[model samples]
Target chain A: MKIIARVLIILSAALLVVGATMAFASSASSGSGGIGPGRDGFERRPPAGAAEGSRPPGFLPGGAFGRGEGRGDHEGGRGMPAAFELLKNLVIIAVIIAISTLISRLTDGLRPQRR
Target chain B: MKPEHRTYIRARSNLLIDVATFIAFLIATAPRLSGIGIHEWLGIAFAAAIIVHLLLHWQWIVALSKTMLRKARASSRLGYLLNLALFIDVTLLTFTGLMISEVALPLFGLRLPRGFLWRGLHSTTSNIAVLLIGLHLALHWQWVLKTTARIFGLVRPTAKPRQEVSQ
Candidate 1:
């Protein structure tokens, strides 16, 4: 269990970095495009050479800094429902708690067993 | 088992939670990184954990306040002031953050015409909170290191709570 917990933490940390990078890959490739979340929790960048009125798939009108959006998870019509967002947050909390527990437990393993 | 050892374990547990929540806060504060959905949820979770941290230290907080009121040491007074400021800043930050939330509430189709100012306020106050937390940690550096050592068995838990000599 301790090993599994450690693996979970390492994988989640790695995934968080990779996932965030991939999510931003589009906007990073596109000049002057803001990074925003897609409906499926991945990021959607402005399409290549998109004009003012034209938006890429899952791109919202205002983008990340726009008035209608504020670092939101889903975009336009493709977004996961709000209920799902809550669930995702719950999952995040669970993962964090699990990681904390596992770490403490692992340290507990190092302690001298009391008679 | 000694009662103080129990307190030591409990304190270490709370500190562990505090550290974990801080890391989560760091990740979720990035608008682009965590997206709206994750950031809002993380914010809520962080807030809940902060409350728990405060509660776990309630006795110390109360005792510190009494000492401060009774003209306690300057260090105790400073610590108390720092904690109070941190609490206020976090409260303000959380309230402003939720006010400008775009994903967490809007998922429920609840939209409030949050002012553009909320964005700026939330960012600035959060930065301040971060700084305050850093200072708080630095002030307790000895305790952090010693307690962490105890937790990892590099040293045994103190048989008695350390005297508040600095306080």
Candidate 2:
């Protein structure tokens, strides 16, 4: 029962965040002649270039969101190769861990010794 | 189970799940290699894993919350703040992913409006997540190494829980 309550609390918090985001987006869009219920009670037409089946350029070969969009060896949307990006992320993680270890050691060194 | 056995089991479980979560994060970060379908599905799975991670550490969360403003160690306070930021960033990342979902939501016959805003937010949040997750793992690096050594039998498991176990 306690576990259930905790799960419920988590779900409620997540829902609140989602709800707030949607509400803020709706209001923002409504103010800017956005996509909301039209005078005819239909969704106002999707914004220009926000058309259906359009995908943004991405590093992934099959594009970012949709399936079967692009499926061959092609350069990433970014000028660099995809492998380089992967290496970059890995290197960043390694560097962060190394620095953290150094800081942990430094803090321990600064602390008073326990006899 | 004996208390020592229980402690060992818990340590092992924590190590396995944390490793899995780290791998999932890595794969999800690289949609280019995993493809869009795997990336989206893995992201949804990652969200579930994160909740489980928190559930496993619920006691620490409660205890820390009770004393965060008072007697908690400076490192613990810093960790708590980092975790809070991670939770918020990941929440936004998952929510925005769902909002801009093209493959997963459509499978359920629920097609949300595709907006540039959702897409942009998803990208931004994911970028922030990389840094946050890096810090999170770094903070726990000692625990991870020690746990792995114990689990692999290079070092015997201790009966007493370490101070850092609260994290």
RMSD (Cα, Å) of model 2: 4.8
lDDT agreement of model 1 with the native:
0.60
Looking at model 1, residue B66 earns an lDDT score of 72
Query: How big is the positional error of residue B10 in model 1, measured in Å on the Cα after superposition?
Result: 1.2
Identify the CAPRI category of the predicted complex in candidate 2: acceptable
lDDT of candidate 2 over B10-120, digit per residue (tens): 878988998998888887777667766887899999999988998888888889999999999988999999998888888888988887676888899987754556666
Clashes per model (N, Cα, C within 3 A): 3, 0
Report the C-alpha displacement of residue A26, candidate 2, in angstroms: 3.9
Write one digit per residue (lDDT tens) for candidate 2, span A15-100.
87777777776776666666544332224566787755443443232224333322212213444554554566777888989998
Candidate 1 — which residues are off by over 4 angstroms? A1-115, B163-167
lDDT of 1 by residue, B10-129 (tens): 768866987797677665555445566777888878776777666556567767767777867766788789887776676656765666677777778976553333454566676676
Instruction: Note the Cα lDDT for every prediction shown.
Output: 0.60, 0.75
What is the two-chain DockQ of model 2? 0.28
